[model samples]
Target: MENRKAIEAGQDITMQKEDFAALWKTIHLKVTDTYEVPPEILWVNGSTIGTLGNFSASTGKAKSKKTFNISAIVAAALKNDEVLKYSAYLPPNKRKILYVDTEQSKYHCHKVMERILRLAGLPTDKDRDDFVFIVLREQTPDKRKQIIGYMLENMPDVGLLIIDGIRDLMYDINSPSESTDLINLLMRWSSGYNLHIHTVLHLNKGDDNTRGHIGTELNNKAETVLQITKSQQDGNISEVKAMHIRDREFDPFAFRINDNALPEIVDGYVFQQPKQDRNFPLTELTEQQHRKALENGFGKQVVQGYSNVIAALKQGYASIGYERGRNVLVSLNKFLVNKRMIVKEGKGYRYNPDFHY
Candidate 1:
C-alpha cells in the first residue's frame, strides 16, 4: 500500500529512500558471510543449468523441436528425476510447476499437457493440482502477464514456471523499453517468488540469434541460453547446445522424435561430417547408390516444387544412412537431374526406374 501511494505521488521506486528494515531480509552479504550457493533445479551431466530464482531460455527456428526439449525439462521437474539428462529437484514443499502457453489453442495445450504427463510416466487421464497448465492465446499481452502474476501469487508452492512463447507476452518484441521491462519483470518474479523460470523464444529467421530486442536482453540477463536446431545432416533430429552458461558447458546432445511423437536421445549417435567441413563438395554417387537414393527419396511420388524436392531428398538420404549437409543436398538434387537419373516429366521430377542404373 505504501509503495502504491509512493507511485501515485510520482516517486520512482528505485530512487526512493532505502527500506532499511527490509535490507537484511533481502540481502545476505556480509564480510564473513558463509551462505551456501543457491540450489539447482535443472542439471545436465550433474552441472547446473538452472538455479532457483533465475531464468533461462531455449531458442530455435520454426519447427526445430524446441518444445520437445522443454517437455523433457518440465517432465523432469514433475517426476523429480532425470529426463533427457535434465533432472529437477523441487523441494517437497515446492513441488508445483506452472506452465503458461501463449501461442497454442486450448486443444493443443492439452496435447502438450498429455505429452508432459507421458514423459513423466504419470497417468494422463488424472488431473493433479501440483501441475497447473494454462493457455493465454486469446488474451491481450498485458492481460496475459496480469493473469500470470495473479496465478503466481496464488500458487506460492510453484518451484518451476515455464513461459512457453514468451514473445507473445509483448506487443512489440523490438521495443527496447518493452524488452527491458519484460526482462526486469522476469528477474523480479523469479527472485520474489524464489523460483526458477524457463522461457522459450524463436530464433531470428536465417540466423542462430534469438528473436528481437527482447532476445538480446534475455541473453544479457539470462542464467543460461540454450539453442536448438534441426540437424543439417537429418532435419528430423534436433541438436541442443549451450549458447551461454554460468557453469561448465555440457557436451552437446541430439534427440529425434520417435514413432510415439516423444523425443528420445539418439544413443551413441555420431555425425559423419565435422561442423567446420559442412560445405565440402559432394562426392559422385555410384549407379547403385543413385538407385537406392531415388528409391528412398522420391519412392513413387514425384514432387514438382523446389522446396518440396529438397525436403523429400533429405529424408531419403537420411534413410540410407547417408550424411548430406543442406548445401550438399541441394547440389545432389541438381546432380541427379543433370545425370538423367531423375528425369523431368512435364513440370515434376521423377526417378527413372530403367535409366541404365
Candidate 2:
C-alpha cells in the first residue's frame, strides 16, 4: 500500500496545456504535408455537402425506403468512379465491405447486393471474397473484438462497416451506461481510422423513437439520418427520406425503392378529377366515363406512399421539408400533375375554378 501510494503520487497522468498544444501542432504538421485523411463517401450524389459529414437517425414508422436509397448510393459510390467527378461521392470500389448481419438472412442480403451492384453496373464477382459477413449466431464480446481487430489489421483498407441491427451487436442494449461506452469506443476507432459505419436500428412500437440507449447515441453521432416507409398499395415498394438531421447546414431529400436498382426519386403526386361538359349527355356516365369525360378524376387510393406524397406537400408551398407546418412540395411531371379545374401558380397548383370543393 505504501509503495502504491508513492507510485501514484509520482505518476504524471495530468498534462499541461502547453504539452497538448505541442502535440496538436506536431500532429497537424504530419497530417498537413504527408498523411491523407479520406473523406466520408457520400451515398447520394451532391448530397454529401447537403447531408453534412455524417448521416445517422431513426426512420418513421413503416419507412425503409430511405435506407434502400442510401445503400444504393453507397454502392454506386463504391463501384462507379465517374460519379465522383460531379458529386462528392465515394464508391468503395475494390475496397472490401464489412457486413455484420445480426437479423438479416444470407439470402435476403444477397438479393439486395445483387440488385444494387447490377444497378451500379458491376460485373459478376465472388461474393465470399468481395464482402465479409459477420453473422451473430453466437457472437461473444471477445469474439467481436477478435473479429474487428483482425479485420482492421488484415484488411485495414475496408471502406464500409454495415451492422444490420445495433441491438444484436451488443450484449446489453438497454443499459445506457454500457451503450455510452460502446458508442465512444466505436467513435474513437472510426475517427482514428476514418471508416464509414452504417447500421440498422429498430424503432419503438407505434413511436418514432429508436430502440434502446445505444440507438440514441448512434443517432446523435451519425453523420446521416434516414427514414424508410413502404407503399400502402403493396408494401413491396418503399420510400426513403434522407436528412442531415444531425448537421444543421444540410437539406433532406426523398427516394423511392427500386425492385432491381437503388431507389430513385419518384417525381411527385397529382390530384385530378373528371372533366364535365354541358354538351355531353346529362345522364351520369359509368365510372370509366366519369373518370375520362370529366376533367376531374376520382381520388385514387394512395397505393403505397400516396398519402406521404400528400403529406409531403400539405403545406401548399413549393419548397423542401416542413416549414411552419408547410410540408415539402414535389411537382409531378407535366403528364402527371393534377390539372382538373385547379388553380396554378408558379408550380403551386390548386383546384381549378370550375371544380366544386
Candidate 3:
C-alpha cells in the first residue's frame, strides 16, 4: 500500500518493499549469497569521501559557514564536476540530488538554492529538474520526517540527499532511544534506496564534540564525520578535518567565503600538526603493517575494553621489537577503529579480517 502511494505519485514500483525482513533473514548471511557494494559518489585525491548506501555527517559551531561547504558539495554532484578538489561521479540512473532544509525559512532556502545554482554554473533564476530543494521549518518534527519519507519514495532516481539540521527531526536530541532510532532510520534509508545521505549537525557550546547523544551515535556509526572548525591560525578562515572516516584520511583543508558568496579553497595554509607524546621507534604503519599488527594483536579473538586493546597491541608491537606506549596505543586504537579495521562489539573490539587493504 505504501508502494501503491509511491506509484500513484509517479515512482517506479520496482523500488517498493513491503517491509524489510522483520524476522529471521535479518541475521542471515550466506557465503553463497552475493552482496553488491555501492558505487563511490565523492572523492578527494583519489581516496573515497562518500559512497552510496551510507551516510556522512559534518558538524560545526554557530556561524561556521556550514552551508557554504555544503553548497560546494551540492554543486559538485549537480555538475558531476570538481569543486575545491572534490570530484563526483554518479551513475546515469541515479543523477538527481535532493536538499532538505529543516531549520531555514523559505527566504533563506531560496538564497541557498541560488548559491548552489551559481556555484554549479547554472542559471540562478530558474530551477533545474535534477536539483530539488525544500524547506521544512514550518512543519512539525514528525511531519518533517514524514515528508522526507514521501520524497524518498516518490522522487525518482535521487542519488544524493542532504538533510540540513537533522536535529529538527526529533523532539529531543539527548534522548538515547530517539537518537538510536534516528540513526537506524538513516542507515535503512541509505541502504534501501541505494543513495548517499549527508547530514549537518552543530557542536556543543564551549566544547569541540557534537551535541548530545545523537552526536555520540553519529560519531560511532557515520561512514565519515567531518568537523568544520575556525582555523586556529586565522579565525577568518574555516577548516575541514576528518574527525573519523572509514577510509584513509585526507589532508585537512580550509576555505573562505569569497565576495561572490561562494566558497574558495585557501591554499598554502600551514596547518599545525598535533604535538607528539612519548617517542616510539615507529610511529606510523603501512597498510600491510597494520594488517600484520592486527593478526598479531587479535590472533582470531576479541579483545575486551580499552585496556585490553592497548595491552594486546603492546604485545603485538613487542613481537616486532617496537616500543608501544600509552600515547601510541591510544592513537593506534583510534586510527584502527576509524578505518574499521578494528570494529567495536558491545564493550569490546575485535579485528575484522575483512578490512580492505
Candidate 4:
C-alpha cells in the first residue's frame, strides 16, 4: 500500500497540466536580461527597427539592388563609431553583430568590407576583429537546425542576426505554409533568444512575392519590409524603399545607393525628380519600348474573361467556362504579371505605362 501510494503521487506530478502550461507560457514570453529596447542601428533614419522576434525578409528583382548590402552599412557604422553619434546623440556602444552569410563567401564579404571601410574612412583592419562571419552554403533542414542551435548556444551576445538569402536555408519558397513553418522556427529562435533577425530573399522575377510559401509568410510577418529596386536613371544605382509593412509603428521612406566604391545612405534624394538623359535613350530604348507599348495596348483592351476575377490575383482566374485565362495571360504577358504593377483592391488591374513604357 505504501509503495502504491508513492507511485500514484509520482504519476500525479507528471500529469500536472497547469505546471506544463506555465512552463510553456514562460518560454513563449522569453525576455532578455536587459529590459531596455535594444538599439538596432538602422540603415535609414526614422526607420522602424523591425521586430527581432520574427524573420524580416527583403526581396527584390534580379539585378536589382541587394537588401543584404545593408549589412555593409552596419559594418560601416561599427567601423566609424562617430557616425553613430549623429543618429543617436549618445556615443555608440560597440556591440557584437553576428552575420550568417548563407549566400556569399568570406572572400566576397571581405571585398565588400574593404569598399565600405574605405568609403567610411575607417580602419579596414579593425573589421576583422569587430565582426563575426559564419558562411554556410545551401544547407539541408537538419543542417540548418544544427547550425542555428550552435549559433544560439555559442553566440548569445549577438545583437544583430543577418541571414543572407533565406532561400539558401530552405528547400522551397513557393510553399507559404512550409515557409511559414520555417520562418516560425527562426522567429521562435530569435524571440526565444531575444535577437534582431534580418533575412535576405530574392523577389520572384516579375512579382514582389519571394520564391516560395514561406517567402510570402516571412514578408508578411516581418516587422518591416524593404524592397530594393534598380534606379531607372542609372542602372548602377539601386534604390532602397522601406516600410513598416507589417508593424503599425513604422513609417515608410526611400533612399538610393550612390556610385561610390562603398555605398552609404545619402540625402534622401527623390529619384522621381526630372533629370537630364545623360545617355542616349533612343538606342537603348528601341526594342524594350516597342515590346512594352504593344503589351500596354493589349492589357488596356480589357481582359474579357477575367471580368469577375479577384483584382489582386494576377493568375489562376477562372470564368466558369473560360479554362484558358492563365494560358492567355501567360502568352500575352498582359493578364499575368510581367512585372509588379499598380492595381487597386477591386479594380481588377491597371497597366502602369511608366513601368512598361
Cα-based TM-score, every candidate? 0.71, 0.56, 0.77, 0.61
Candidate 4 per-residue lDDT over residues 317-343, each given as its tens digit: 222112233334343343223232322
How well does candidate 1 match the true structure in TM-score terms? Answer: 0.71
Candidate 3: residue 81 Cα off by (Å): 1.1
lDDT of 1 by residue, 1-357 (tens): 998898877754454345755675566666776766877889988778998889999999999998899999999999999998787899887899999999999999898899999999999888999999999999999999999999989899999999999999999998888988999999999999989999999998966657888887786678888889888888899998887777777888899989988889998877554433334333445677768878888888877987878887888777767766677777677556534466554346777676533
lDDT over C-alpha atoms for residue 195 of model 1: 93
Model 2 agreement with the true structure over 169-209: per-residue lDDT tens digits = 57787777777777776665566555666667766776544
Which scores better on TM-score, 1 or 4? 1
Candidate 1 Cα errors over 4 Å, as ranges: 1-29, 271-357
CA RMSD of all predictions: 16.6, 16.0, 7.9, 12.5
lDDT against true structure, model 3: 0.84
- Models sorted by TM-score, best on top: 3, 1, 4, 2
Model 2: how far residue 19 lies from native, Å: 13
The CA lDDT of each predicted structure is: 0.84, 0.49, 0.84, 0.53
lDDT of 3 at 188: 87
The segments of candidate 4 whose C-alpha lies over 4 angstroms from its true place after superposition are: 1-19, 22-24, 27-43, 51-54, 76-94, 116-121, 126-129, 243-260, 265-268, 273-357
Among all windows of 10 consecutive residues in model 1, the one with the lowest summed lDDT is: 273-282
